[model samples]
Target: MDFRGRTVIELGAGTGIVGILAALLGGDVTITDLPMALDQIRENVRRNAAAVAAAAGRARVRALAWGRELSSFPRGYDVVLGADVVYEPRCFPALLATLRHLCGPRSVAFLSCGMRRELGAGRFFDTLLPPHFHVELLRRHDDTDVSLYRLTQQHDDTNVSL
Candidate 1:
């Protein structure tokens, strides 16, 4: 996607590669993960700092826990992106809550996930989302088993089926 001039946040940034990519794409990025990932996150950020800065915007590393809810996240952003974060059943509720809370006046979300049924997490999101958001199919990359979806603001209707 054209990330130019967008305030973006990435969830479950295990290696920070995606955030670095977004930074390179001209997005101001904040990469967050569970506190346990702090060391790798810092290392990755340090390794890519110059490139990220060269992309012409700020980049930050944040501590975020997926299943736990936060009253307010680091900041409101125009776009939220996550890669390979869908795993486990509890993640759906918390991730959705986080996305719901982080969503701005015109926020957009990009979620990159594998099609592995063993994970069985994407279905939860698919079954759960839609009433509160509008989903658009984005490009599915061939390099990895990852598919990117675009999410935009909409209403929440608990009764809607996935």
Candidate 2:
């Protein structure tokens, strides 16, 4: 998608590669992860600073623990990105809460999940997510068993029980 001038936030960014690429595409991107992972993300962001600047895009790193201190983050982002973040079933509620808080009526989220059957990935996509967001399958990579999904907030009061 065209990311120029868009406000993007990436959750569970490991090395921040995705967010960096978004910035390089001219999006104002925020790459976030747990406190312990910030240094690695910051380092990667630094390595791509020149290219990001040339693209007239911005990338910033922040520490974000899902479902904690969410108020510190600004609401209504244009896009949200997450990769391999849905593995832990225990984290589903917090992750869902985080996604709900970050996304506004017009916001869209793109999540790339590496499907590990033992991890309950199917349950997350089928059950946990449908209540709060309208989920669509954007692409599937069978070789890698990774599926990319596009999600938009569901505004109906009947489905807002999350």
Candidate 3:
């Protein structure tokens, strides 16, 4: 996609690989993980900073607690990225809420996760979405499912193109 000048945030970045990919692809990206994952994020960021710098793309790692405060995040990002973030019954609501708060009116979120028996496909989306998103299942990677969503709050309509 055309992410050359877009500010992007990557959520649940296990090793910051997904965020790395976005940065490498020319998107301005910020990599976020829990406080415990800071080491991994730093290592990956350090290893790739030279390459990313040459590409004119920037990447940074910050501590993002999903079930907690979202006010720590800076505002105005064009895209929000997440990978393998579904499963916990208790954390699902907070996760989706964080997504909504981080992404502004005209933002697109790309979430990739392998839906398990626990994360029911029927009740896929949380009920808290702002009713202004277009969700699309991009493709299934082996047993993992990668989905993309276009979140636009300018209007109040949820249209899914199945």
Candidate 4:
């Protein structure tokens, strides 16, 4: 997607590579992760500062644990991104809550996951997410067993279980 001049947020950003790339593509990106992970993300952001500046984009690191302090994060980002964030079933409720909070009526989310059956990836993709978002399969890399999905907030909020 064209991220130029758009506001983007990356959830569970580990080293902040994806958020940095989004910033490099001219997005005003906020890369968020747990408090313990902020140092690495900050380091990555610092490393890419020059490129992001040259692209006229902005990158910032923040500590955000899913479903905790939802009110602390501003609502309605233009794009929400998550990479390999669905591995833990115990975190599903929080993750879904975070997604719902971040996405507005016009907001879209792109989530990529390496489908590992042992990790309960299917339960999240097949059951948990469908009730709250309009899920669409954007692409599938067969060789890698990874799938990219595009999700938009469902219009009918009452149907959301979480």
Residue-level lDDT tens digits of model 3 in 63-108: 8888577887866589988887765767867776787678776787
The pairs that clash in candidate 1 are 132-155
Ten consecutive residues with minimal summed lDDT in candidate 2? 153-162
User: Clashing pairs in model 3?
Assistant: none
After superposition on all C-alphas, the RMSD of every candidate to the true structure, in Å, is 4.6, 3.0, 4.6, 3.4
Kindly list the per-residue Cα lDDT of model 4 for residues 96-159, writing each as its tens digit.
9999999998999999999888988878888998988999999999999999999998787566
- Looking at model 2, residue 5 earns an lDDT score of 83
Q: How do the residues 69-156 of candidate 1 rate in per-residue lDDT, one tens digit apiece?
A: 5664744688898887777765688888888778864898888788566767557557766766787768777776677788887854
3 or 4, which is superior by lDDT? 4
**Candidate 2 lDDT, 1-162, residue by residue in tens:** 789989999999999999999999999999999999999999999999999999999999999999999999999999999999999999999999999999999999999999888999988999999988999998999999999999999888866677
Sort by lDDT, best first. Answer: 2, 4, 1, 3
Q: CA lDDT, every prediction?
A: 0.78, 0.94, 0.75, 0.93
Of 2 and 3, which scores higher on TM-score?
2
Model 4 ranges off by over 4 Å: 157-162
Q: State in Å the error of residue 88, model 4.
A: 0.5
Q: Worst lDDT window (10 residues) for model 3?
A: 121-130
67: Cα error in model 4, Å: 0.6
Q: Give the TM-score of candidate 3.
A: 0.83
Give residue 133's lDDT in candidate 2 (0 to 100).
Answer: 93
